[model samples]
Target: MTDLSNAIWRKSSLSGSGNDCVEVADDLPDAVAVRDSEDIQGPALTFESRQWSAFVSGVKRGEFDLA
Candidate 1:
């Protein structure tokens, strides 16, 4: 498991003060971490940097959007 003790988590500006969004921390070397904003003490999912980049790209392309 990746050590994210020092991870700086941030939610999207679009979240607009809601506690229902996911938070992301991309400052870790070679890794990115995501966790539920409403559950900061819960487990976080970590991803390889490249993998996270690809996922972000897919999001930008609406690959995961509901039809």
Candidate 2:
């Protein structure tokens, strides 16, 4: 298991007032941690840095866009 004791999580600045966003912690050595803003103590998903970058790129390109 990854040691998240020192993780610093941050939410998107574009998010609205509703707690309907996710927070990310990229301070880990080799992985990025993501957790729901509504559930701080909930389960977190860990992804490789490269994988996260690719995912972000896809998001920027609207590859996951839905009508």
- Candidate number with greatest TM-score: 1
Alpha-carbon lDDT of model 2: 0.94
lDDT of each: 0.96, 0.94
What RMSD, rounded to one decimal, does every model reach? 0.7, 1.0
Pairs that clash in candidate 1: none
TM-score of each: 0.95, 0.91
> Tens digit of lDDT per residue, candidate 1, span 3-43?
99999999999999779999999999999999999999999
Clashes of each: 0, 0
